[model samples]
Target: MLRNVATVIWDGVAPFEFGVVCEAFGLDRSDDGVPLLEFGICAPQPGLVRTSLGFGIEVVDGLGRLEEADLVCVPAMRRGDPLPDGVTEALWRAHDRGARLLTVCSGAFALGEAGLLDGRECTTHWKYTDQLSARFPEAKVVPEVLYVDSGQIITSAGTAAGLDACLHIWRQEYGAAVASAVARRMVVPPQRDGGQAQFISRPVPEIDAETLGPLLAWISAHLHEELDVDSLARQVLMSPRTFARRFRAETGATPYAWITAQRVRRAEEMLERTERPVEWIAGEVGFGNAAALRHHFTRVRGLSPQAYRRRFACGESAESA
Candidate 1:
């Protein structure tokens, strides 16, 4: 039922985030049995808008285009950028008319400025989650997830997560088959688990846990082995209790959790790049069997191993391209 997508842009807009919105709704995929939408780019000023990377693009449409769109998307904006009052009024008017609103990255800040994020469950990029929470006390900021779809308003994390959020919308409106088709063209996973936490840099490297970094790297390399806190602790020459404490303090997750997360990440790479069978991938990534791999993969990615392979595997598409 969703159609007529509009992307709003402003000065200091991030180009890649804007492109994510465009890729989701702007494509002419009618030949592939996908719906074609009336996608347009709009800005309040209706002229040149500068990108965060010091580039400029001409905006041919003005705010009037948003009046006709069934969905409005806002891309990431530069931190501390001034959001014009007209943009907020346009957003409110679109939402009042039952248009779905979505924001990517720091663009949530613009929604926060518009008062739309008030008392709503939302998220921005992980690095900026604290700032967003501090700026809007009424809004619930979920930092760990890739995106949040609170029905009418969808907010995503950083750059690549915007693609995830957009694929989620495609899956919701057009079904998995259609979403998979679009994602195949885009060369990204058709759907990713929104609840899956982003793999942060040393996700939690404080608390003098820097020594655990090398151990994590080792586990990432040898995911095929059966691993446990006790064994891992032995490698670091610490007691199991002390190692568990240090692991949680450093990575914000247990040994099992961190290992499963990394295994899932490895499986994803193989799923996308190789034509290998699920059973083989399971063993290769330490899941031991297809069923276990499927369980953990689904828990982390919101889709089955076979389903992910079908949707993302570079099979016929990669060779033909």
Candidate 2:
């Protein structure tokens, strides 16, 4: 049902964030069975809109174009800039008429200015979450997750998290098959677990393939085996403590957390690619049993294994599952 999309831009809008919306919905992909969207770029006026960088983009339409949109997108913009006339009012009218509102990174500040985020749980880039909350004390800000979906308003973290949110909307509206196909075209993961906390700035020691990179590839190949810190340490000729430190420094995740996330990714592929039973997938992915797989899969994906397969499996594989 999310066919029409209107992306509102203004002076100081980040070009990369604005491009995220255009890449996700503006391009034509009907040959891949993905629905084509009626997408447009709008500004406060129909003219050149200056970007945060040193350039400008000519916009063809004005805010009036948002009137009939099914989805309205606001990409990252400078937090201190004043909202143009009718910007918040137009957004309120769009939301009131049941159009979903989405923001990328600091763009959530506009919604805060509009009072739409008051009493609603929302978030922005981690660097700005504290500022977002401090500025709009009534809004509940969750800083850890990649994105937060509080009903009609979806706010994503910095940079590529916007793609994740867009794919999420695609999965919800069509199915996982379409979302995965679109992700394939974009050359990014179909879905990713774990929160953006892993991406926060950290001082990592200098590392190379001689360190944990090859070990990671090995772990992916042997996921069904028991992969504990002690066992992994022996493989790399280091003690458990040294290996654990090196692993976290190189990958930004503990061995257990990274391994479990990979196992879940493998399980997801198997569930979609083969009509295999959940118990078999559980064993193959190191979960050992259907009950364990169901617990972890549900916890990570927000849906049960059976439900995920039902939502994502393709063609005859889908019907059989």
- The whole-model lDDT of each prediction reads 0.84, 0.84
Model 1 clashing residue pairs (backbone): none
Residues 1-321, candidate 2: write the lDDT tens digits: 889999999999999999999999999989998889899999988799999996999999999999989999999999987899989999999999999999998999999999999999888988899999999999999885678788799988878888888887887676666777789889997865425342633344455536577889899999988778998999999999988877777765678878888887788777767888899899999989999889988876778888878767764555323
| Superposed model 2: Cα runs more than 4 Å off | 30-34, 96-98, 171-180, 198-211, 316-321
lDDT of 2 at 258: 81
CA lDDT for candidate 1: 0.84
Looking at model 1, which ten-residue stretch has the lowest summed lDDT? Answer: 312-321
How far out, in Å, is residue 216 in model 2? 2.4
Report the C-alpha lDDT of model 1 over 200-300, residue by residue, as the tens digit.
44555566645687898899899999999889999999999989877866665678887887788788767767777788888999999988998998866
Candidate 1: stretches off by over 4 Å: 200-321
Q: Count the backbone clashes (under 3 Å) in each candidate.
A: 0, 0
RMSD of each predicted structure: 7.4, 3.2
